[model samples]
Target: MTCLICGTPYQSTPTWSKLFLNQLDSSTCTRCFEKFEVSESTIDFTDFLGTPYEGAVDSVFCLYTYNEPMKEFLHQYKFLQDVALAKVFAGNLQQAFQTREGIIVPIPMHPEKLELRTFAQVDELLNAAQVSYQQLLVKTKSETQGKKTKMERLETSNLFEAMSNIEATNYILFDDIYTTGATIHHAAKILKDAGAKRVDAITLIKG
Candidate 1:
């Protein structure tokens, strides 16, 4: 098989060592795996919002930098619909951090976009990692973030809405990428307004 991120060929034979390492490496070749630079910093949500939002996201734990390899991987996994590539980050995500008793909420996709894409990328990542999550939020707007400019993305409003009353106090919002922080911030606001006490987020890449 080929490395998911770099496309370098490697042995796919099942063995004890390979199986043990696969749990940690997600089948990525050694060189490509080493290329993923782990983030030691966090993004503050308040920086993106012009005015302070009530119950804003506390912090975001991003895993990888939006480097060329990660960019190509995301484009293929998300845009090109290479669903199997979701496994590439599953191991990293599962080990990113521990959550204090709360539901893992994936940033919601609008029904129209879901119909076209046939899957939510974040949900697929959690699934590959065997992490349980709740689809508690929904995107009210059908707009795609990739086409929007920085200002437009930041100024966009009412993009997300809570589906129902959540009994959980803490929620971990998951997404594929964090570009301007608009998407996760808006989603966290909705969750907070719906009675979520604290909202934290995790993204595969910090662009």
Candidate 2:
């Protein structure tokens, strides 16, 4: 098989998990996959501390740290519209979610941005991983959060509105990346306010 990220041909090795557990293997080869650094840094919630949104999110689980290879991967998959690249991290994402319990909810993109991007990048990740998820929130603000400063981002309000009545159940929010975490917090707050018992997040890259 050809490594999805580096385009180098490599062999896929079968293991106990693949043979018995039916675990899906990542599309990228071992060498290219190793370029994504595993993230161990804990996410801080001080930005929402002391606010109504304090404790909105229970915890955040990040798989990879932002790096050069991941940067290039995001550029090609998200901006260049390479939908197939979503499968690159399928094994990693699936394994992470298996140990967690919740109603998987993917963060929704703004309608305008989705139109421009031609796809919901976050949802595509879940689809590629074969993870079941619900669309529970709608992005309200149309402006991109990337251009905003940290304070400005935290100050941005009503970023998401609940799509339906949220049950008093645990929810796992999925996203493509976690930066200042404003986006994830906003979505979590809305769900919590709408009656979700607990909210946690899983992000592809910790930027």
Best by lDDT: 2
Candidate 1 C-alpha lDDT tens digits along 59-157 = 788888988778778788889998988888776777663444568999978889888888888899998877889888888998777898967776778
Location of the lowest summed lDDT over 10 successive residues in candidate 2: 45-54
Alpha-carbon RMSD, each predicted model: 3.2, 1.1
Per-residue C-alpha lDDT of model 2 across residues 32-60, encoded as one tens digit per residue: 88888999999988877876678989999
Best-fitting candidate, scored by TM-score: 2
TM-score (C-alpha) between model 1 and the true structure:
0.85
lDDT of 2 at 25: 81
